[model samples]
Target: MTISRRSLIAVAAAGSGLLALPLVARADGTLDEVKKRGTLRVGVTQAPPWYSKDPKTGQWSSGLGVFMGKAMAQSLGVKFEPVEVSWGNAIAALQGNKIDLMFVLDATAERKQAVDFPATALLWYSLAVLARDDLPVKTWEDLNKPGVRLSCAQATTVDSFLTKHTPKADIQRFPGNVEAIAAFQSGRVDAVGMFHPPLLAARQKLGKGKLVVPTPAESVPSSVAARKGDTAFVAWIDKAVGEYYRSGQTQKWYEQSLADFGLDPKTVPPIIKEMIT
Candidate 1:
């Protein structure tokens, strides 16, 4: 489908007619309410590459989610309103009518019970490691040694993954991604393992280490979240997300976000699963 700038602007112009209507009066669907309210409230948090808040300005800055959110809102002829929310409360935000949508949330079975997700994925992110230049890691097994040291966030999927697959390696646990990466920066650990997006920025900032998605890469598809039973909203999001991927806009936004984060896109692993090599 061709999405032209003129078409998007036309849609936005049409939304002005419904701007004065009360949100409660729109019972047709979430889309109707959004048009009436003239804003698309998207849940966001301080997650780099996906969503990040500027400390000095207290504004939603460059990230894949921010770009996509703006594009989605524009297509709907509404303003983009970012509602700050953490991973734990993202679903609750939707349930409480606090936010209309959220991006990059994993569609786990447990979460499915509480919220709806698009049939299409926003992107894929894989478990990757930022290891010392000298470490010879071609696969997960290469790191499963008694001498190798790894650091990851405590009680996270990364921690569990290392414990199961690289049991012999000395895995250090930290409070979060920042602390875990810091351990590697301090030379206390030979590698730090986490999702590749955040590691992209870390590698650029530190100017050392090799970011590798070891052979037989383990990855997960992440999707958009909406309030449960909002079939109309979920269907629209699915179509929009699918179009973004097929047209390569998803990758473009991701690469743009990397550049905005001061990282070279060529040096980082692609977030789209199929693009990884």
Candidate 2:
């Protein structure tokens, strides 16, 4: 997908305190190159509080990833530049050297094959269910039945979760979360699957419906990812994230983001307690 000049400018502007990150080639001397170019390139997507664009304001909010990326850029004494990447290509963009860092990533074992996960996780997410009030989606088993209809964004963890756990259910897939939510809102599907926070954001826009936990919310670690061999940059990321986690700075940004995105603080999953503390 073409990165619109408008999008680039918005990202560049959003990160006022951030060091300039450009979407060009990854230089060999990680620190030296960034200092010389005066920018630190990071990847982003329109994935709500993580990274999102305001339709009304036409502005970009760093959310969590960009918030953290900005700090990293500051440490490097450069500006943060965000590169447009889809959920499907975020990993590839990092591993292929198209982007220096992917600030938001799920640390699945399979993904660990291509990227290195730092010991310090940036945050955790809970997979939650959003179903029609009338639908009886009390558990994963209930959604697993052959006739029950479920919708999840394509190429997402939610999609893989439903496919792997509820193979018998009728699953309708959409290109993105917006389309999937539209299907659910229109009563064409039973439930919309996503992380709890994004679902909270959806509820703000689509009224709070029957949002339920299908099972015990599984805490998934979300981290910054880098190519397997970029040992120096990866180590720096680990140090940076560890410091943020230790100083309670990450939690601070998270709570502020909750307010910024209109997500109710109480609705944040208990899994965060395990990760944050």
Candidate 3:
């Protein structure tokens, strides 16, 4: 995953000139407002193996969001400023100009109608029903049966996926992943609906085996999003992401980061790499 010197220079050139474009306006109608202010505010959650804090330094680490923010800032020649937010607060943070970009966001049709998604298919995240090995739930279809409680984050893509495909299942909403996992551990829920990486980490930490099943087909891609109408910013971001993908830097980051979290990079489907390439 090496970037050629020529491509690196081209990316740097693009970043330096992105601000000169009149169309690269902020969500509030100002050009490169984030850069003009000298900081790129990024939205992220505190979910482990996805987004989390370094207890010793009080700095952020360990998530795709962190890497995405770092890469975005480097490509755009801006300072990276992370805003730790809950799932509930993420969208408002973007709309209120508290954050310039939301990473690890699900690009649903409903959300796309509001936010500008510059990087689509950044990661092919799977929705899974994580359950203790003792549970009978082994697949997406099994989770749809009656008397099974499925816990998920509120207003998340998992919720929407469940609503659309497993409408009959009893769905429970938690404020965040911690509560959802807590409920599952307490036997209050039959299974927790979550993304793949976090579920794998949780199982490792608990020293228990958890079963994970992919969501039914028709799930959306996860993406990086900006406020609606920020076409210039979106275009600039699109170019940066394309360059990163082509350079193979993204694959390198994935391999290293996933290994750090005790997850297997081989779990990423080959088709996802093809799509990004």
Candidate 3 lDDT tens digits, 198-231: 6766765765546455434333356777776778
List per-candidate RMSD values in Å.
Answer: 10.4, 9.0, 11.3
Best of the candidates, lDDT: 1
Poorly placed runs, candidate 1 (over 4 Å)? 1-26, 53-59, 153-156, 163-179, 201-207
Per-residue CA lDDT of candidate 2, range 1-277, in tens? 3557764554345323221233334447566777887888888888767776677886556477778888899988899888888766776666556777887677766566556777778777778778887788667888888778888899988888889888998999999988988888888888888877667677778875666667645557788877666678778888998888777788777766666877765545433434422
Candidate 2 off by > 4 Å? 1-27, 54-59, 131-194, 210-216, 275-277
lDDT of 3 at 60: 83
Report, for every candidate in turn, its global Cα lDDT versus the true structure.
0.84, 0.73, 0.66
By TM-score, the better pick of 1 and 2 is: 1
| lDDT pick, better of 1 and 2 | 1
